[model samples]
Target: MHDGIVVYPTDTLYGLGGDALSDEAIMKVFEAKGREYHKPISIAVSDPDMIRAVACVDELAEEFIDQFLPGPVTVILPARTILSSWLTAGTKKIGIRYPNHEIALELISRFDSPITATSANLSGGPDPVSLDLCTVPYDCAINAGPLSGIPSTVVDLELREIIRAGAEIDAVAAFLAQWS
Candidate 1:
C-alpha cells in the first residue's frame, strides 16, 4: 500500500490525498492543508463494493452511483462500519467520490482502499485547477496533468438535498427527485 499523503489531479482541483483508513496518513492531509478536523474529509473509492463497504448504501444511492459516479459528484451518506472518525471528524456521515479520470481510478486502484480526496490547497486558499498553477503542497503528488477544472456536485443523502450544484446538477436532481 502507498504510504503518506499524495497530491493529484481531480475533477474539481488538484487533491491532497492519503489512505482513508490510516489515522497517520489522514492526519498528514489535514496538516498539509492546514485544515480543521471539524470538517469531514472526502474519500475516493474505485470499486463499488469498496464504497458499499464503508458508506451505508440505499437504492437511491445505488441509482445515483450507477448514473453519475466516475464523474464529477460527491455523494454524502451515513458512515458504515469501515469508515473511521478520522475521516468524518465526529460526524456519522462521509462524503465519497468516484472520479471519471483514468489516472484517478488508477491511483485509487493502487491504494486498494479508499484515499482522501481533499482539494490540493490550504483550507482557505484558492484551489489549483491546472498543472501550471498547481503546487505540490503535500507529501507527494500523483501527477495527472491539469484536471477538468470543475468541482463535483455535493449531494446530502440523509437530508435528501443538493448541497452544491455543479456541472451535473440537472442529472443529479432528476435522480434525487425520483426518490421524493
Candidate 2:
C-alpha cells in the first residue's frame, strides 16, 4: 500500500485496499476502483486490539465480535478513532473484519494498522474471486486460488440487523441473542 493500492486475498474474496490509516492511500484505492469517496469501505484488522483501535464496540457488539469474528463476517461498529470521512464515508460507522485467512491477517499484523477491505473489482461490478479477474489498478496482488465468490455476511450490531446475509447469519444472531 505504500507504493499504491494492492489487491489481496481474503477469506471471502479478493479485496482492494491500501493503508487504512492513510487518507492519501485510501483515496488512491478509491481512484483505482473508480469508487466515490462517499461510499464507506470496510477494513481488515489483525487482532482484537486492532479492532478496538478503530471502532467503538459496546457490550452487545463485543459479544458478536468475540463469538463470530476471524471468520467470514463483516461487523459494522461505531467509529472510535478519528479517521478521514473518506474511510468511514461520512457515516459514523465502520465495517471491520478479521479475515480467517492467514495471509490477510499476517499482512495487517505486520503492518500494525488496518487495511482497506473492499472487494477487488470495478465500482458496481461483481466481486472478483481470482486476482486475474480484478479490473482495478493495483501495485501488487497475492493470489490464493479462487474464492467462493460469496462475500462475508455483514451485520450492523448496533441495530441488531443483518445487512447482507453472506455467511453465517443465523448463528451470529443466535450467538448475539444469548447476550441480548
Candidate 3:
C-alpha cells in the first residue's frame, strides 16, 4: 500500500498508518477513519532515532521514553520542521508511539519510516481490539488476533501533564513524578 493507508496491529488496539510525511497519505488516513483535520494523529517510530528525526526530545521526554517505550505510551513532543502540518493537525506538538508488539514493531521497522498510529475505527467510535472490528478502509490489514483493548496513555512532556488516562497511566505518572 504505497502512499496509502494500512490497517495494522498495535499493543493496545488495531490502528491505521501511512507515510507520516505525506499529506496525501495522511488525508487518506483521516478520510478512512472519518477523522476531522483538526484532530491530530500520532506516529509510530521503528527506533529511537526515528523519534529524534520527527520531534525535539528533552531530558524528561527522553527519560520517559527510555523507561516505557516499545510498550503502551504516547509521548507528545515538540514537532520538528520535517513533519508536515497535516501530520501535526495544525499543532506544534505531535504524539508519538513505540509499540511493544513484535508484529507492529516489525511492520514499522520494515517500512523504514514513521507511520501514522491512529486507532483504526470510525471517528468517535469504540476502538477496535480485533482486526475485524475495524471498519475503516485500508489497503492492507494485518490481523494479530485481539489486542489489550486498552488505549495508550498520552503524556504531554512540554506541559508536564497527562492528556489521556489509559492502561499505563499509573506507571507513567509515577515515572514523571520523579522529575517534578
Candidate 4:
C-alpha cells in the first residue's frame, strides 16, 4: 500500500487491504468499500505460524494449514486476545488465509499482521479478476497482474466443516480428512 493503503488480488477477489490490527485503517476499508460493520472481514498471512500469533490455532487447524495454506483456503478459527471487535464483528472467531500469490505473500510479510482480505468491490458485487475490470473505490491498488482467477475454499475449522467451495478443494479436503 504505497499510498498508505494496500489493495491486492486475493484467491476470492481483489481485496482492499490495510493494517489488520489498526482500528483507523480498518475503518477506512469499511468506509471506502461501503461495507457494513456487522459483517466481519477475513485476514491473510504469509505463513501458517503467523496465524498462531493472531489467533488461538489448534493442533488440528495447524495440521490442516500445513497442508492447505499457500493456496486457496480460508480457515475460520477463534481470534486471539488482541483482535479488535471490529475485525471479528463481535464474534470470537476470525477468518484467515494464505493466498498462493507471491505479491500477496510479500505484502502480508511486510505488514507483519494478518491483512484484511475482503473483496475490493462494494458489498454484494462480483469480485474483480482483472485490473481493467476492478471498480474498487480506493486510493491505491496493488495490481499483481491477473489473479489466479479462483476463489479460496472456505472451511470453518471451528466446526470442522467446509462452508464454501472454491477453486482448490481436493487439497483442503485431503488435509481435513486426515483429522477424522
Candidate 5:
C-alpha cells in the first residue's frame, strides 16, 4: 500500500493513515476526511529511529520522548526537509506520534515508513473510537475492536505548550511545568 490510505486503530482512536512521504497518499487522506490543506497532519512512527528520520528531535524533544512517548501523545517538533510540505501544512514543524498499540506499531513496521496519524473521521466529526464511526474512505481497515475514545494530547515541544489536551493531560502538563 505505497500510496493507499488505511483505517487502523491507534492507542487513542482509529487513524486515517497513508504514506507520510507520498503527496498522493497524503492528499487521499485529506480528501477522505475533507480536511483543509492548511491544517497540519501528524505522523506515526514505530520507534525512535523512525521519529529521528522524519523530525529534528532536539535534546528537549529527545528527553520528552523518553519521558512520555510510546503512548498517547503527539509531540510537535522542527520538521526535517525529507517530509513533504503537504504533510506539515507548509509549517516548518511537524507533530509525531509513537503509539503504544501493537497493531499500530506493526502497521508502521510493515509499511516501513511513517504514516499520517489523523483521526479517521470527517474534519469536524466526532472522535472515531470504533470502526462504525470512521466515516471515511480507505483502501483497508484494521479493526482492533475499539480504542480509548480520547485523542492523543498534542504538545508543541518547541513552544512548550499543550495545543490540545487529551490523554495524560495532568502528567504532560506537569512535565512541561518543569521548564517553566
Candidate 6:
C-alpha cells in the first residue's frame, strides 16, 4: 500500500502501518487511530541495516538489538535526522521493532522502508490480536488469523529502562539487569 496505511499482522498484534518517512501517510495513520501528535509512534524495520539507517545505534543499543530482536521487543534509540519530528513526536528518540512474523517482515522487506508499527486500534483501546479487533481504517489488510494478543516490550536503550512491559518481558528484564 504505497502512501497509504495498511492493517498487518505482527508477532504480537495487528498493526496499522504506513511509510514512516511520508508525512502524508503518517498523518493518515494518526487520523485512523486518533492518536495525538505528541505521542510518538513506533516503526517496523526488516533488518539491522534498516535499524541503523533510522536510528543512531550505539554499542549498548547494538548489544540490545543482537540480544533480543526479530521477536516481541521494541528498542528506543536516538533518532537520525532523516526521520521527521512528527514521527518522533518532536523527541530525539524513536522506537523500532523488527518483528518475528513472516508477513510483517516480508511487508517491510518489500516496501524497502520502515513503516509505522502502532497497534491498529483507537488510542487507548484494547490490543488488536485479530482483524476484527482493529478499529482503525486502513487501505488494505493482511489477515494472519489471531496474534499473541500481547504488544511488544518497549525498552529505551538510552535511558536503559522498560518504557512499557508486554511480551517477552522476563527476557528483556534479564538483559537489562545484566547491563544495568
What lDDT would each prediction earn against the true structure? Answer: 0.82, 0.86, 0.91, 0.79, 0.94, 0.94
* Ranking according to lDDT, highest score first: 5, 6, 3, 2, 1, 4
Off by over 4 Å in 3: none
The residue pairs that clash in candidate 6, if any, are none
TM-score of each: 0.93, 0.94, 0.97, 0.90, 0.98, 0.98
How well does model 1 score by local distance difference test?
0.82
- The alpha-carbon lDDT assigned to residue 87 of candidate 4 equals 88
Per-residue lDDT tens digits of candidate 5, residues 57-118? 88888889999889999999999999999988988899999999999999999999999999
lDDT of 4 by residue, 1-180 (tens): 532456787765677788888888788888877889998888888997888888888788877777778777888999997888898999888999888877888878887777788777777767678776566577677776677667778898878788888877876677678776
In order of listing, the candidates' clash counts read 1, 0, 0, 0, 0, 0
Q: How close to the true structure is residue 19 of candidate 4, measured as C-alpha lDDT? A: 81
Q: Residues 1-180, candidate 6: write the lDDT tens digits.
A: 778999999999999999999999999999999999999999999999999999998999888889888999999999999998988998889999999999999999999999999999999998899999999989999999988988899999888899999999999999889887
Candidate 1 local lDDT, 67-152, one digit each (tens)? 88888999999998677797888788999988877778888898788999888877877667865554446665666666667778
Better of 1 and 3 by lDDT: 3
> Please, what are the lDDT tens digits per residue for candidate 2 over residues 1-180?
573787888888999879988888998888888988789999899898888888997887777778888999999999975666788888889999899999898888888889999988999887798888898988888889998788899988888788888888789767767655
Better of 3 and 4 by lDDT: 3
* Residue 53 lDDT in candidate 2: 87
lDDT for model 2 comes to: 0.86
